[model samples]
Target: MRTVARVIAELLVTFGLVLALLVAHLKWGTDDYTRRAQRGLSDELDKVWSAQSVVAVKPGRAHAVTPPAPAPAKGRPFAVLRVPRFGASWHFTAVEGVTDADLAKGPGHYPGTAQPGQVGNAVFSGHRTTYLAPFNRMGELVPGDEILVDTATLTHVYRVTGHRIVLPTDLSVLAPVPGRPGERARRASLTLTTCHPKYSAAYRLVVFAELSASRPRTT
Candidate 1:
């Protein structure tokens, strides 16, 4: 009986160690992987923006409405999202899909939604507590906060309208008008979503913003 008890105790310790390692990896190891991925994505954006892939706005078209470009292939990155309120260094490459693999690269654009600067809801989803947690500080955003999205040609600036906490099953937030199904979107809008309360996917925290301006890219 003594030998059996010792074996059981050893097994429990081993399990505990494994669990601790997993927690650490989820919190820190994933962050390391995400940082490396971000660097690569940033480099890709730099190349595209500096290359012939971009369309240069004319001298008199500074405020001209730039139409939305066609969606890129899934998992391919197409833009960069930045929140000034999050800090000067806060930015994430926005990709084409929100699947596990795509989000592992960065914040993802929901397929079938409006693209940046378009007159509809442009939804982006990101991990709240892992993979560098780009939206980790999303809760700190106020109604007047600015969300900037940079494509190869223009920077779309969105002003936060409001935010809400909803259940995981809340599909209304994904509507073309956001929280208003079947309603026509009259203004260009942006919605950001992430797992709520940190480390829990029970609910989603959604932030709503509307496009306030678009600036032609200079550099």
Candidate 2:
């Protein structure tokens, strides 16, 4: 009986160690992968923006600049999101779609909504507890904080207006005039959504902001 008891104790200890390792791997592995993806996306954006600087000079010397490329395809990155309140290094590449696979790379832009700097709301979503928890501190955002979206052509600056928690089924929050279904949008806005309360998807935490300024990006 003494030997049997000793064996059981050893087994339990082994199980505990294995569990700890698994948890650590999941937490650290996801963070590492997200950082790698962010770097790659940043590099890609540099190339994209560089390509947008093509210039054609007429015989008389009138130069015409080529327009920026269209938005990237679904699941591809199109912009970089930055919130000053999140810290100096707080930024993420926002992909075009919010699919599970796309989000694993970083925050994702919701389909069918206004693109950044457009007349309507531009919506984005990110994980709260996984995939580096890109929006882990989203709840910390408060009114008047600055949120910036940088595209190849322009930098759209938005100021946080408010935040709220809502059920996952609340599609109204994705409207052209967020939280107001069937209403005409009079202003450009930004909405960021993430799983609420940390480590749980029981609700969605949304941060709303309005475009405060937009400026052309100097090469």
Each candidate's lDDT (Cα)? 0.89, 0.90
lDDT digits (tens) for residues 110-205 of candidate 1: 999999999999999999999999989999999989999998788999999999999989988888899999999899999999999999998999
RMSD in Å for model 2: 2.1
TM-score of 1: 0.89
Regions more than 4 Å wrong, model 2: 1-8, 58-64
RMSD of each: 3.5, 2.1
- Residue-wise C-alpha lDDT for candidate 2, range 35-103, written one tens digit per residue: 899888888878877787677878878664868578678877788898888787888988999988899
Candidate 1 residues lying further than 4 Å off, grouped into runs, are 52-68
Q: Which residue pairs show backbone clashes in model 1?
A: none
Best by TM-score: 2
Q: What local lDDT score does residue 56 receive in model 1, on the 0 to 100 scale?
A: 57
